[model samples]
Target chain A: MKLKTLVLSPQSRLDEVCSEACRARINDYFEPVWNETGRDYTQEELSERMAEAEVIISSWGSPSLTDEMLQKAVKLRAIGHAAGTVKNLVPKQIFAQGVKVYSAAPRIALSVGEYCLAALLTSLRYLPEFDSAMREGKWKIAGLKGRELTGSTVGIISASSTARAFIKLLAPFQVDVLIYDPYLSEEAAARLNAKRATLEEVMSCPIISVHAPKLPATERMLTRELLALIPDGAVFINSSRGPVVDAQAFMEELQSGRFFAALDVFDKEPLAVDHPIRTLPNVLLSPHIAGASVQGHLALMEEVVEDIIRGLREEKTMYEVNEKMWEVMA
Target chain B: MKLKTLVLSPQSRLDEVCSEACRARINDYFEPVWNETGRDYTQEELSERMAEAEVIISSWGSPSLTDEMLQKAVKLRAIGHAAGTVKNLVPKQIFAQGVKVYSAAPRIALSVGEYCLAALLTSLRYLPEFDSAMREGKWKIAGLKGRELTGSTVGIISASSTARAFIKLLAPFQVDVLIYDPYLSEEAAARLNAKRATLEEVMSCPIISVHAPKLPATERMLTRELLALIPDGAVFINSSRGPVVDAQAFMEELQSGRFFAALDVFDKEPLAVDHPIRTLPNVLLSPHIAGASVQGHLALMEEVVEDIIRGLREEKTMYEVNEKMWEVMA
Candidate 1:
């Protein structure tokens, strides 16, 4: 018999996340019941569906699985989250019930990594500056020469999945990569074709990218002193959580016009209209979109569906998130 | 005895192209005569130096080697050009006189390829749009989702050195690459991990890039109908010569908002102040700098110096341009 699967994401999101092919595969493997509502399921609605679901599929706006809900979900053997983080969707209590969990964080990391690389290349080559000048009827502005990515030193703040993905994309550039992550061993760094360095050393690189997770320990890890270490004419990119950096310090450094930066996240969402950063000439600002893409969304659904199938077949799933991993994952 | 080498480029350019280490290496290998003047040598000045030199170093702004000057250079054995396209610098007669020639076209190609990939990623992800919106204090504009490079198809207009470098940099993206080059064999396309396709078939891809050379046959190669073949929401990039495309047709296509483009070249550069292209919303304009960069300039000097050293040692040079190759080069 096919597993009784429950899809908790709203129909509108499902339209984007799950392609027609993915839905066909889901129908082939499971007796699936999807959320037909145009919005996220209410807690009462989720509680009612939990009792009958042998397998659950969740995404960005899905209601959290509480202990009360877990009590009703006795038939739930697995939960596949078609989104980056399951931290908000799956409570620790669900793990105690012996339910398997899978996440599409790795898939999201690929998009984020690609964004980071694009941001770096764009900033390093002064692409925006050139485009702006050209639009203003200028040509080859004096002293506007750009630098190449080849044979340069790149510093990564953490060896998170997104950081690893970015490093993989950088392999062809012949650049020296320095990674700063307390958890990354020398052997692990070597395997990634990078050198393990202190946070200070990483900050000193001409091109520094941050990919730290949003955790208490990582909050404001980039202090005023560390921000000061970045050299003149350097390009700083931050695609990870905004809280991982000291907002005041970063702004002060950028104000000096000694370096350039591409920032995709902020300490607060929808950066204020009159925010000082908005007027800064040395920075390129974008809404938090490093991990959001149409292709990435579909890939997330495909990954979760495949993992759910592997779970039913008693096979190894690539993205399984056990209790230990969940606690430390971003 | 060291070879007598005459540097024909202006001193200002040498300061930018040749690093201190490169100058020291040149001193060690040859009795070098520096171009002390801050301007390009006149034809008469170049002819006087030609009589005493066994090797000649040329770059942008250097006077051309006319047949009259070639007759005066009795001891000339080699010419090393620290720039792309020696077509403007060397005469065809130089090859007939048995003078070895080396050009840094490959090094410049590396920069152009990197620029193309950067342009593709920037346009695909709608980075410029997002940045603009964010600067205007907007967040998460509706229906602004981007596509990924991971699984898309990329069309290349030619298999020139710049195109090959771009294909190499795309190795990790897992995107299908279609190259439109009549001279490229299926086996050659396979080596690049790309498919050989007709011009029309290549133009139909969602992401189209042009790297065609500026030759009599290639001029206006991308006609109105060919430009119309581009699908909606596609990204078009051109880092090669602008005259290779029909400029009027390209402007009209971009005006329709059916596609986005990042153009670095124009039929006539310093694009007119009131040009309609400057006001277009769906296009990103940049001065012709795809093949120019600080690192690329130094690399050009380094490559030519290395090749010249190899020639003196009776070793095969990597970037030697023979008569047959020069006849077909850009």
Candidate 2:
């Protein structure tokens, strides 16, 4: 059967990948979203344009597939997300309409995993702040103190795809790796060059990292109790979900100047102008951006293209989402 | 004979390494240049303290050892540099006084090589700026274009110790590397896993890294002609002396937004507050800090300790600078 594809966001790389995949699969593919006149279409215009769209290729900032929007896309059969999270685009009505949902979050996780490894090592080397100090032509300390990954302990807190890829990236570094996951088995951790440990054991390591998903059980997992157990000067990192950590508890540890943290996600993003974390001397803060390097976006686009191709060639869907259980399953 | 040493800086790591080595050898090691009150000392004071000092360990910002100063250190038999660049402390007096010089710049190069590699890859992934944008709480352009080091051409200019170390660091990545050095033989480049190239071939590659030393012949080697040859969106890295790159020429190329640069050095020591390069979007500005990370400093310290150990054993020194010209090379 011929497929009709519509792109909602303007990630140029995404559009190119999806368009190529669609053209290879069918001749009736179409684009319903465009920035003509430098503005997007209104609700009515969107409805008219999406009337024949069989699949939607989406990214961040895409309009939601609400009940009304679904009504207009009567023929829509699938939604392929060319980004990490699909929490915003998949409305309650999407599953009812039997529309398949796919996400490139896993592929994105791999690319981001590499980015995280780079950031982690750079943090250990104290590159950014030093670079900043040097640019100002001021040497805060005439010299620096740093450690190498060799013989160092690095703890990965979750079995998330990105975290898994991070293991592959660290293979050549020869550092000891520990993984903490209630659901993970010792054998699985070993395959990734990691030793499965309890959360307490993981946090107590010299280089503890957070990679847990955002779930009720995982939220604030690094409480004051767990954080207190970490060794002095341990490197704490989070490239996963933000709310998974307790901000106040973390701030307490940070204020002590006992540990170093490399944070890419936080409890509240764009942390407040006067947020205490911003003032910490030893912390490395980056907005919720650990997964959004240009390489990541391009890699994610490749995944979206694969999903679209599978949708056309395979009788079974590639990234079908069960609406009733998404929050729990994801 | 009793071994004598002098510490020329107040660096703790240097002190730790030197003390450990001295303890192992039961030698008399004195720290003569520490800032007791931040005032330069009289020659008589230095002479009195360093009467039997046979070796001097040096680093950045150490007092110059002019011909006049060497007369005070009459028994000085050898000088060990615990840092890169002996240009500041290596006076005609030390060489003329028949003092053999040793340097840890080779050891320090390992860390600098690792740092510049990370920075180069970071630029390829467009990281620092992406993280900066995320800090502002806005995620724009989900990802930019990213290329891997695998199979891509990487050009290295001037085969200094850092350049050689960088080549060693890149070995596992399995990338095609090209090198241009007036002093390097074709056989040497091949042994380094790099194909020797002309200046033209080096500039044409997507990534050009500089490791040229601050010699008269290398000044402004990256002229307008060379900088302009890099393809648009290619990366340019300068971890060596800043004068090697004509700053004015680089500033002009930056305006085109075609080439991205990561500079750990600059033409001027103190970059003016409004230095155009500081504000430029295409460049990563650092205050001459590539070879000065904490690890880099520690590596130098280790090298110095190794030299002291060799001296106590009556073995050949590890980093003798003027070996060909000195009778007491060991």
Q: In model 2, what is chain B's TM-score?
A: 0.85
Clashing pairs for predicted structure model 1, backbone only: none
The lDDT leader among the candidates is: 1
Query: Which candidate ranks first by DockQ, i.e. highest?
Result: 1
Per-candidate DockQ vs. reference = 0.80, 0.19
lDDT of 2 by residue, A1-330 (tens): 446667665544445334454444433344444334333345565566677888777666556666777877888877788776677667777777778788877766765676666677666766666656655645444545555664568888987788886777666556788888888888888888788888888888988778888888988878889989989967888888788888788789889998788777778765665566665667767666566544455455456656666665675644445675467544
What's the C-alpha lDDT at position B107 in model 2? 74
Q: What is the interface RMSD of candidate 2, in Å?
A: 4.0
TM-score, structure 2 vs. true:
0.73
> What are the per-residue Cα lDDT tens digits for candidate 1 across A1-330?
888999888878888888889889988989999788889999899998888999998888888988899999999999999998888888898888989999999988999988988888888888888888878888888988888998899999999999998999998999999999999999999999999999999999999999999988999999999999999999999999898888998888888999999999999887887788987778878888989888998878889989978977899888889998889876
Which pairs, if any, clash in model 2? Answer: A134-B287, A135-B287, A144-B294, A294-B143, A294-B144, B101-B321
lDDT of 1 by residue, B1-330 (tens): 988999887778888789889889888989999888879999888988888989999898889999998998889999999999988788899998999999999999999988988888888888888887877878888999877898789999999999998998898899999999999999999999999999999999999999999999999999999999999999999999999999899888988999999999998876888888988878878899999889999878779989988987899888899998899888
Distance (Å) between predicted and true CA of B84, model 2? 2.4
